[model samples]
Target: MANFGRVIELTIDDMIFKMGTYAIEGTIPFDNDPIPNESEIKIWNLSPETIDRIKRGSIVAINAGYRGDVGLILHGFVSKVLTKWDGTDKITTVYVLDTDDISKRKVTDIAYAEGTLASYILRDMAAQLGLPVEQFELNQDFKYEDGYTANGEVTKIISDVAADCGTSAYVNKGKLYIRNLRYGADDVFMLSSGTGLIGSPEPFEDEDFKGFNLKSQLQYRITTASVIDLNCRRFNGRVHVRKGSHKFSATGDFMTEVEAILP
Candidate 1:
């Protein structure tokens, strides 16, 4: 079902078969889409540690490991064909080399599918402090309410509800396995029911502290995002993202409804 439009190609060892262990080094997307679509396939999967740079007729670039932070970049193609002449002795065509072009080092790598890849890694760590990735807009919602002060002493007044896309104390832990791609069938994995209860955040605010130390200075925060709400659109393809309006939200199963063969 992957004929998308027709240009599907792949071979830098089949786009490294979705680098499930990282090593993708860099990548960012939003080419604006001219065609192709089958969920646009973000963060497909990767594990061999990646760094091979990619070999054999290389071309590579297929989304990324599951939960793919979702920015964009799942184009495809790479083929010289796995050659072999029946006449034996003079058939050579498997070659692929030069190619690198990529971005994105940490969004906690997807931070377990948390709110748009940690809001694009907190807008790439606030564009490395200089901020202004087109100026203020990576989400900034607020809603607070605090309670507690009468006497029992438990009157908590907590209501700093944020849901736009402009904050993060970056935390991550992922493990997706799924199944039917088959080998037994019940793969499983996909954890994080709040991983034992969201308790492990302390960027800083200490004195003589005894944990995670970066000289005490700290600033990291990504609030919320986790999309694809059309009932998950069959295995995940409706091209989600807009949780709090980071933007981009395509459907029709995220694109391709027939024909797809990109590599």
Candidate 2:
């Protein structure tokens, strides 16, 4: 049995991404839950470009291995605060909100990807599990610069939502992310000698880079942001939201609210 010594029960939400046996965790969730300390929440807090790149990276990682199911965001606000065993890691046990909870309103069971070799199989998971745009502190806003033709026609380049626009998510150093993805069935694959199979990007350096796959379809990074913004409405307390789904919503906040979320 798990130890229950001098136990104190507090509630919080959590997220994790599954790529084979490896899982990358996300933030703790709550719509308006209070966090006593600054360390309680750790949104990327990077430059706008970096934030976008992280989002793009997440999109790429999810879609890179997307079979069907969408990635999860275990979003919930802080319910109760604890003062003991407070390690550097910002984590706690959430109440584990369920669909039946009153304040949470609608709750849907996300498939555990029982059959697929990866973690998920439900394609609409991200779309169904996203939060609203209003609550998105992701800093995803974009800025526009203007250029003039020889005749001064005056053209503008939207550095935010265009392909190869170099607006990808930010990572360490000077590298940016390219989170493009596609799910067309006509895709083809090549096998690697040592690693087995990886989606084809370009020719591999060694003979082991056998699985050079390619896709004829394309989708935008913005499309990904919208798709995962669903379920942004559900919060903890009155309603019992699901464990690993979005509860805040930005469905109609497109023009003003969402625009401000960009880098």
Which prediction has the highest TM-score against the true structure? 1
Best by lDDT: 1
For candidate 1, write residues 184-241 as lDDT tens digits.
2122322121211122222222332221101100001110112111111122122111
Quote the lDDT for 198 in model 1: 20
Residue 129, candidate 1: alpha-carbon lDDT: 28
TM-scores vs. true structure, each candidate: 0.20, 0.15
- Give the per-residue lDDT digits (tens) of candidate 2, residues 60-119: 111221133222322223332222223543332222221211222222442232223110
Which 10 residues in a row give candidate 2 its minimum summed lDDT? Answer: 253-262
User: Model 1's lDDT to the true fold?
Assistant: 0.22
lDDT of 2: 0.20
Give the Cα error of residue 234 in candidate 2, in Å: 22
